[model samples]
Target chain A: MPRRSFELMETHIPSLRRYALVLLRHDEPLADDLVQDCLERAMSRWHLWRRPGNLRGWLFTILHNIYVNDVARAVARPDVVEIQDYFPAMAVPPNQADRIRLREVTAAIQELPDTQRQTLLLVTMEGFSYDETADITGVPIGTVMSRLSRAREKVRAASWGETRENGRRIT
Target chain B: MSDLPEIPTEDEIQALVDGRLDPARRAEVEAWLSENPDEAARVAELRDISGAVEQVYGHLLERPIPARFQNAAAPSMARSPVWRVAAMIVLVAMGAAGGWFANDAVGPGGDPNVNLARGAVKAHQMYAREVRHAVEVPASEEAHLVAWLSKRLDAPLRAPNLDVQGYRLVGGRLLPASDSGPAAQFMYEAESGERLTLYVEQNLTGGETAFRFTEYDDVSAFWWKDGPLAYVLIGRGGRDSLLTLARATYQELNP
Candidate 1:
């Protein structure tokens, strides 16, 4: 492959790592492992990636597929640990209150179903359009919208400390 | 009455929060939000969530990519016969240079010390010229810097005092060192504004080696291994000057 192609892929890695971090719910090592697998797969399949295409979306699609396959394999095993138990220990100190709130938001994101969390992060954090997100996640646009809405509502409720049972209904 | 503004849908509200809406639709959402306090609050909350996610996880973007992942593009390049021959020619040329070139052909699968030296040179070329962000954690917090890098590398690392050599500790950052695990880089600067970096990592293939020196363009490096740790001292100075600093580092680190 051309060196420029590799550089282009390199530019997307930060976003890829960020997306993977949230997807795997802050497990840094596992997230990096997923990214490595994605990069390797993408490199091996470089000919399959059409130029004049959304490379970011293509890469995310590869990462999401790898993650899904890994999850599928893990499902066959009974010893998987709850993802919530893996909240990362803070390496650097931030303002206590802000840290707590961010932790709450992260926890809320982790609690979301896989599809919803993926949709929400791809849209909100990674700034993918609904169409692009649908393409990446292999779902319809309407499904992306619904998953995003539900994911945002749950996260909003959790952050605001509003119980779904008693919170004023969101129309 | 026929010209009434259309109320935005749930998806439209989200689009507004994500700043994905077109101008006409965004204006309509803004107009609606102006009159609806509760909806506006929820939109604000959603916006906050995105910001918080960026705040919480954005630091990963600033990290140096691991050497293995950075080399992910190499496999394809390696498959090409032309590139393979060209790489072999370059490797042969480097190998003829002596001392440091002894293990130069080992590439990624070679001696751990050689990898340490190459990784250090790559990092120095990458960060030593930066006007800003030269190191992840500056030396003002030397104690904390050492502690954090030590924890990451899982070795008790120190930013060896180079002040006697007129080099002051600037700071250090954690780096991924191929498949060997994490590496730490500590940078130093002299009054002439010349900068040097010390790259340290755990020597998983544990044995000691004497100093090996190599130069790439203007930059030169001297790398050695001690029990449980490998070190590479990189600079733009003459080989002799760098060796002097390296020896000082060895003494301080060993003592």
Candidate 2:
């Protein structure tokens, strides 16, 4: 329990919060709660963390597990909030048109399947390597790449006014 | 060179957009893109998607981490509800001792300056003892350090010159304030190896307070609110000497 370890872990909290917010589709309170849970779990299991291991990836693995568990629990309940209801409060950006585009992009990301969305965010937004993303998501490297590709394609299509419905791509 | 394909695979194209390709492969992809305008446009679209994703979510990194999450690593306080309640009672008692009359003074989401000071002290204790990695950005890059921290905290910040007091700038790191914002911690060290840290955060309550002192174990902190920000100077020195440093820091920052 050296102080250095705590300090190092603290450095990663902002990134953790960022990942959590995206994973939970910008539900700030729920995201913070998940991060708190992840950190507490990490602290209790600090001994399992090898000294030279990638701590960021380790924390993400823990967070992804907790999120999956929470999703499972929520699916059992009847009053689950619709994922569409959690769009971020639009912070005022300098440009009006850019804000609209940004909102569309965010919505498109939200429309992705859970696995695809997780892979896309971890690689594109959080800047994790493909190997690290696969490790964190517990998928093979090829699966990670395919998920990311599909996610990006869907987002691109959404922006261009194309949508996929009932196994058919439509414009 | 022989391994280079005539047309990049989808993964390789995605990697090209992500800037993950090695130089030789990247050059090969760019050469192909130059010949294939349609494929190049698709690559551009992929790049735009990533950029938009970052644009949509990047500000979360700047937001202050909540108070509860800040202590997630503390062993005694991690999961126990009883300890959390006890911790709240202790905070309220400390607020009363400090003569703050408002019920929320130092309570959860109450007076943020008190929480700021506590955060400052915690950061000092955690980082000041380090021989290396003491600060995220070192004093040699003082301009970049100031600009980066100021941007994160959303306030213009000045690292006070403590040269006259024999402590030089050791650099600074951005910390999560107990409230919903970022705090900046600038570390300084004397020739004798004694270290001090100056913590700054955006003032939530605009009401300015005169300098107040607090001690936690061996470390002492002098904190106050000035114009747009709150300040805390933490050190292990005696009161008068640390006060001298605090006053010097205050003047440097305000002026």
Candidate 3:
């Protein structure tokens, strides 16, 4: 590992954590564990990690992969999360209604199909662009957009306490 | 005559949000958003969702690096593959510990400390390249500088003299090194505008303690361990000059 590579990893650590936290859901220990694992992979692979003009995106790809890899996820979940709680945005004005709505979003994410969940988290949760989403999830670009669209529709419908019929959400 | 307005389909709205739409479709979505305030509001809501997710989970990204990762996987320093392709993954420069020379990617020998020196040398090279603020303590204050560094490393030493080789101390600094402890760097410059740096850290505990060299592009690095400290000299100077500097460093520090 070149000296700069570790620097790169350090700079990217926070962004990696943001993505992990969403998946791990304020589960500090597990989220931290996952981020650490991702960094180790990132430092080792930093050479092949052509900036591709997006180091942040590349890191999210590593993190998301680790999250979904069955063995690793199994290892990550058991000791880290305690029922996956809410992080209710600090500035949310502390309204019961707002908290309820936030629950809808997280719950919808949890209910999303794996493809939709990962894609939504990568795009919406991790701030990766659609193109980078494909790179991270190893899915087609169309798939990333479609999954995001489906995920959003599900969240909105779920938010309204409604149902989604195929792609259409009944409000 | 016309009571209905053209609305970009939901797909087009998604394409717009995804930034995947062509300029023509994008213009159409803008026109739609302008006409339908309600839909535009929803789009803003969704973007907020994206931002919120980043907010909630992004904290992990911002938190202190966990300690467990510092002591994570310890692969063998030697890679003699059960699979042949694992060779490509070894770092391009392994320093004295199978660095750039060994292409073994997947095995049980990837040492974190090996990555440590690589991290320091790379930091030295970068900060040294900056002319305006090359070092926190310019070599002009060798005494106070030595006192400061000695306190950090918990050791007694001055900037080892390199004037014998036409290189004078540019300055020194104490930096948070790899996953290990702190590191001390003594940078030098020759009259001809060439620069070299000796990055040193002591008592490397569980890392590979060997003498190795790696060349990345025009830069050459010579790394070795002497007694209780590890040193790497980074420079673009020829092998002979760089090696002489490394030896001078060893003699000055050890003798």
Candidate 4:
């Protein structure tokens, strides 16, 4: 055990947690377990990590693969979620307007398709480049780009509601 | 759509927002964005969704680490692959300590520019997703934003206008610098929800210089120095697009 690798793994816990929370839709305990599983795998494979370009990206790739292979169905079931379910655990704003705004945005995100949601979250929220996202998701870079675009469009359309301007629905 | 030299494909626009386009093509896509406010705003909105996702879940990073993860220490003994295991045991015995493992993490590195770029990117990642609480002082208080950040930094700072580029000030916050001085970050957003951030710090010896681009992870930065203040414009766009914003910012701030 290099011990240093463990320290480095410690630094990445926050990132892994954030990614898992979003991916698992605010299920904190389940997200915790997923990150725990990820770290455990990384520990066992510490010697195999080939000190490459980005350890963060490598760790994310492993987590994503596990997510796809094992945890995808458990976490990504869209029909199971209702927008109202998003805020009970969160600190609700006292102001009604702010609460409404938060609800709309959260609902829009909750409505996104699974793959698009994952790709968009990884790219926009986590600051992963398209290449890094593709590597993590095991998809082509083109697929990552398209999924992000479609995902964003859907969220925008959902949050803003569609308005007709020049014969086209504008978000 | 009818008269432009070429319209960037939807994929290109997606790439533009993802900060993955190459320099040459980035300019073309940026030109398209500048010409099309509707498209630009839509792109900005798309970017905002990520911010929204981040805002909703970002607090997870601050939550206590679960015991299972915290307890997983690296294995002291390796039973597989005798040579590699022997090598690992030797290295552990030697106490080399990330000897060949550490590279390009956020820290005091060789290049000040790269370090600054990293800082800017990191701050951008941290707060750009915040909707109501993204900035310490909101854009509605622009005058106060400049005054407060300037006072804190002990250097004159301006929130560069990015209107022509279709990005408006989202607001700003004070950030602790890796060095002794303080740093400030100004976040801006296009109508579509794309965000670009300008990070300013007051400790550099270089005079006026050309824009240079660097990336840490997915965030891209375009930075330059004007006397003491170093300004870094970070966003999802590639070099050509970021260069355009950087030049516009430079002119506004310098003027």
On lDDT, the leading prediction is 2
TM-score of 1: 0.52
lDDT of 2 by residue, B1-255 (tens): 665447888999989989999998889889889889977866777887887776666666787765555455445223332212111111112332234423344665765666777778889999999998999999999999999999998889999887866789999999988687798999999999999999998888887666777766787788877777888899986554675566557656754
Candidate of highest DockQ: 2
Over B1-255, each residue of candidate 1 has an lDDT whose tens digit, in order, gives 124457889989888888888998798778878888878877877888898766666565666776656645544321211211111111112343345544547688876556667788888889999979998888899999999988988888888887766889999999988446899999999999999999888888878665667777788887777777888888986664665466567767765
Tens-digit lDDT track of model 2 for A1-171: 734566778888999999987776655655665677677678777888987999999999988877776542442222323433323532534265555555566778877888998999999889999999999989899999999899988887777553212212111
Give native contacts recovered, as a fraction, per prediction. 0.38, 0.46, 0.22, 0.45
Q: Per-prediction RMSD in angstroms?
A: 18.0, 18.1, 17.2, 27.4
- Could you tell me which 10 consecutive residues in candidate 3 chain B have the lowest summed lDDT? B80-89
Candidate 3 vs candidate 4: the TM-score winner is 4
* lDDT tens digits, residue span B1-255, model 4: 344648888887777766678988888777878989988877776655555555565655677775545445634221222121111111111112222113555358555755776677778988887777888988999999899999988888888877756789988989987465789999999998888889899866567555666655556677777777988788886644564466457657655
Give the CA lDDT, 0 to 100, for residue A65 in model 2: 79
Best by TM-score: 2
Local distance difference test scores for all models: 0.73, 0.74, 0.62, 0.69
Error of 2 at A72 (Å): 5.2
In model 4, the runs with Cα more than 4 Å from the true position are: A74-99, A163-171, B1-5, B19-27, B74-255
Q: Scoring each candidate complex against the real one, what DockQ results?
A: 0.19, 0.23, 0.15, 0.18
Give the Å error, residue A8, model 4. 1.5
Query: What tens digits encode model 1's per-residue C-alpha lDDT throughout A25-89?
Result: 55565566567667766886888999889999999998888777654344232222343332243
Give interface RMSD, per candidate: 9.4, 6.9, 7.5, 8.5
TM-score of 2: 0.53
